[model samples]
Target: MSAHVLIPTTSNLPAPRPAPDRSGTPTPGRPNRERGSSPHEGERLRPLSRGQVEDRRQELGDLYAEVSGGGPWAWNEARADFLRHLASDARRPGFSLLIAETTVLTGCAYGFPLIGAGPWRADFGGHVREGLLRRVAPGRLFVVSAIVVPPRVRRENQDRAWNLARRLQRRLLADDGAALGVTLVEARNDGIAETLRSWGWRSAGDGTLTAVPPGSCRVLVLTAGT
Candidate 1:
C-alpha cells in the first residue's frame, strides 16, 4: 500500500511573531538585523527521533494549523488530518524528519524510503521511464511526503523558505544515502510546483503523474548531486 501523504496547501495567515534573535545577547543601541535578510541566520536543521516527534506533537499540530489556514479545509480538521498522517508516516521504514528552527520551529520536512518497486511506477500511469525505475534500486528512492514551511514565510522572503525546504530535503536524502528524492504535488498547487522546480526538482514525465489521479498530481524528482 502507498504511504499516507499530506500535500501542502497555501495559507493566508499573518506571519507569526518573529522568533527571538538567539545569535547573541542584544547590545543596547545596536540595530537589529532585518528579519529574513539572511535566511540562514540563527537557523539550524535538526533531525528528530521518533520519540522526539511524539514529544513535540502538539507543537507540530500548531505549526500545521498556522501554515495550513482554514481555506478549503477547516483549521481544526486539517490539523487533525495532519496529525493522523504524521503518525502513520512515522511507522514507515526509514522515516525521517528535520525541523528548521531559530528560537521556534520555522519549518519542517519528513519522508521515508520507498520499498520494493515502490508505488511510483504503478501509480505514475506509465509516465515514468522503465529504465529509470530499474536504475533506482529498492530502498534508494526517498519520497518526501511533506514540506511544511509557513506561507507567510514564503511571502515574506521566498528565498528563505526555498532554502529551508531545499536544506530539509537534501539532509533527508543524504542521511538515507538515497539515490533520488521524489515528491508528488497536486497539479493545482502551482506555487509549490514552481518552487520545487526552481530548487532543481525536475518533473518525472510530461510534468504530471497519475498516482493521485490522472493529471491531478505532478511527480518531481531530485537526484543526489542535483
Candidate 2:
C-alpha cells in the first residue's frame, strides 16, 4: 500500500486537495495530511530477515582475517593443512572438497570468495587470511575450500576461480539483496587491479601501500548493498 501526506510549513495554511489513484478516484480513508513526518522516514532500509542478518554478521567477522598484515608466504603451510582437513571431510553430508591445478572445482567455489577476500576467523585460530570461504551461514547450508598450487601450476585455475567468484556473488545478491560487494586483491603485476577497475570498482585506497615484493598475492575486495 502507498499513501502521500502534506504538511503546512507556514503560520497560516490553506486546505489541500485529495489524492487520486491511477483511475482518478479519490482514495477513501486517506491518512491525515496535516501531520509532519520524520525527515529520515524514507531513508530507513527494509530490515533483513533475522537469519539473513545473522549470516551477515558472521561474514563481517570473517572478513577481518581475510586481510592480513603479514605476508602470504608465512601462512601457506597452515592454509594447506586447513585445506587438507576440508578435503578429508568431503564425504560428509552437506560437504565436499576438490583439488585442482589451476581452477577450483565445485567443492572449492565457496572458498574462492574468501581467497579473493578473507581473513577468516576461527575460535582456536587468530586470523585465517588466505584460502577460500568454505562454511556458509545457517549451519552447513554451504561450505567449500581449496588448495592454491605452487607457482609452477598453470594459471588456468585462475579462470575457474574467477567463474566461481562470479557465481558466489550472484548467490549472495539473490539472498541478501543489495548487501554485498566483491573486492579483488592481486599482485601489483598480476593485472588483478586493472581487472577490478574494468568491473566498475572505483579504486578506494591502496592496501599496505608499501613496496610489494615479487610474487606477493593481490587482494580483491567485493561488497553488496541493499
The best candidate by lDDT is 1
Whose TM-score is greatest here?
1
List the candidates' TM-scores in order.
0.72, 0.26
CA lDDT scores, all candidates in order:
0.68, 0.28
* lDDT computed for candidate 1: 0.68
**Per-residue lDDT for 113 in model 1?**
81
TM-score of 2: 0.26
Q: Which stretches of candidate 2 lie over 4 Å from their true place?
A: 1-108, 112-167, 173-211
Tens-digit lDDT track of model 2 for 95-184: 322222222111112222221222232310221132323323323122223221221111112233233233343344444332333332
lDDT tens readout by residue for model 1, 26-76 = 469965443436535557899999999999988987787766655445667
